[model samples]
Target: MLSLQQLSKQYKNSELALDNVSFDVPSGQVIGLIGPSGAGKSTLIRCINRLIEPTHGAIYLDDVELTQLSTSKLRKQRRRIGMIFQEYALVERLSVMENVLSGTLGYVSFWQSFFRKFPEPLLQKAFGYLERVGLLEHANKRADQLSGGQKQRVGIARALAQEPSLLLIDEPTASLDPKTSRQIMRLIKEICKERNLPAIINIHDVVLAQTYVDRIIGLKAGKIVFDGSPSALNASVLTTIYGKEEWNTTPACEEEVSIAPVPNFQTKLELAI
Candidate 1:
């Protein structure tokens, strides 16, 4: 579990990126963080990971106050937080298996990792993660040879290799085509539930997020504007978060549309809703 209390971030120029934002993430829950551009969604994640220090307030992971930790302690705590990047941050020359194993670097000795001599059990675990992401067949391929979706799958597998307590995903579908984006979203949701792992995904596609995540946190100009189940994200809440637009206020009988592709343009119809 993670908690943010009165968290805020102000740049040297005194422009507030996150203003007194507070929230909690419970175990086995996936939260979709949605907002307009420059709404501080990315900033909040960076602050949580201590990549960008919070200008004020405290961050708690379990009972530990992350904001108060020493550098060495912070480094160790970071290993418990998994990160999946929008850019598919991978070593181009490394094989898919090696890339996933890199996630365990913090747990392994320097010489062991440098020599790629991961323990046999760890190697087997990496293989399991690869298979989970449907990349077992490509384990020997270089990262650069992967397509966009394959690369992101590798990214997901790498993050899971950390066996992290919480997942922090930044625009996991930002670069993929529409279908692939949906696949990645569904994959992340399933994995989080299966492992009882809590996750916070900073996402752009509102419909996509609403479809896959358990909850939605809407940000507006660096503040928490809406925090509730995806079903609560009616026209009014979305308008407040993203500014005025002709939103679909139709109270359809369906709660969440199934994510599978269908004939007669059903997938497109569901997305349009």
Candidate 2:
């Protein structure tokens, strides 16, 4: 459903975030993008969404040239794509229902959304989505009151509210514990299967990706080095993608450990330029 051809993103001062990266996310398939830090997994996904403009090449969503679209046209096109962020990206002061309803803002009238006035059917759909994510009881609670896992559930519900044909997830389980991460991964996989949605997710956790996605695409310095099923992603591919022998080692607790000098999500905005 999505095709990226010879994509490249070069920032100022000659920094190359993506170097002619190309790949495809076929209809009804769940694909995983995995690599170590600074390998450009996130960059490629952003480029596909036009969240960051590609320095070169074309991005086609169902054969529609997304890179050539005007801002207004891009907004309309994005209504068919749903994104779930690592941070959950919920509005802290808003109620869970309000945040889920925000997903439909892409479809709702400006005046109705501005006034937080959702139609009854839309509200009912939002309620059903919340229930699906096991968050029905917390529908009226403020986003800030929910736990990390709960907030991510709300994020999933928000994305589902869009009823998208394509899903883009950026480290969807990054902040949750292992057990919670597994639960979230299973939820995402199930959602894609049940809804027949094609998805591409950037994940640092190799085990989770292998366990959940139908295929794995490994990136290294913004280039695709591996594209195949999980069983085909051997040590050599991991070494090429991560540029580290450690990443090729057995699945260890280190992948779960948080990074020091934590990365700045705001830096991604810099990456766009």
**Candidate 1: where are CA atoms >4 Å away?**
249-273
lDDT of candidate 1 over 1-273, digit per residue (tens): 999999999989868999999999999999999998899999999999899999999999998899999998998888889999999999999999899999999889999999999999989999999999999999999999999999999999998888799999999998899899989999999999999999999998777887899889999999999999877777778779988865653335442553433222222222221
Candidate 2 Cα errors over 4 Å, as ranges:
246-273
Q: Candidate 1: TM-score?
A: 0.91
**Mind giving the per-residue lDDT tens digits that candidate 2 earns over 1-273?**
888889999978977889888888888799998877787878777887789888999988886899999998998888888999999999999999999999999889999998988899999999999999999999999999999999999999999999787999999988888889879998999999998889998887776777789999888777788898876765566667765454333334544553322122101010111
lDDT of 1 at 273: 14
> Candidate 2 overall Cα lDDT vs. reference?
0.83
Q: Which candidate is the best by lDDT?
A: 1
lDDT of 1: 0.88
Alpha-carbon deviation at 269 in model 1, angstroms:
11
Q: How displaced is residue 84 in candidate 2, in Å?
A: 0.6
In candidate 1, list every pair of residues with a backbone clash.
none
Candidate 2: RMSD to truth: 7.0
How much does candidate 2 score in TM-score?
0.89
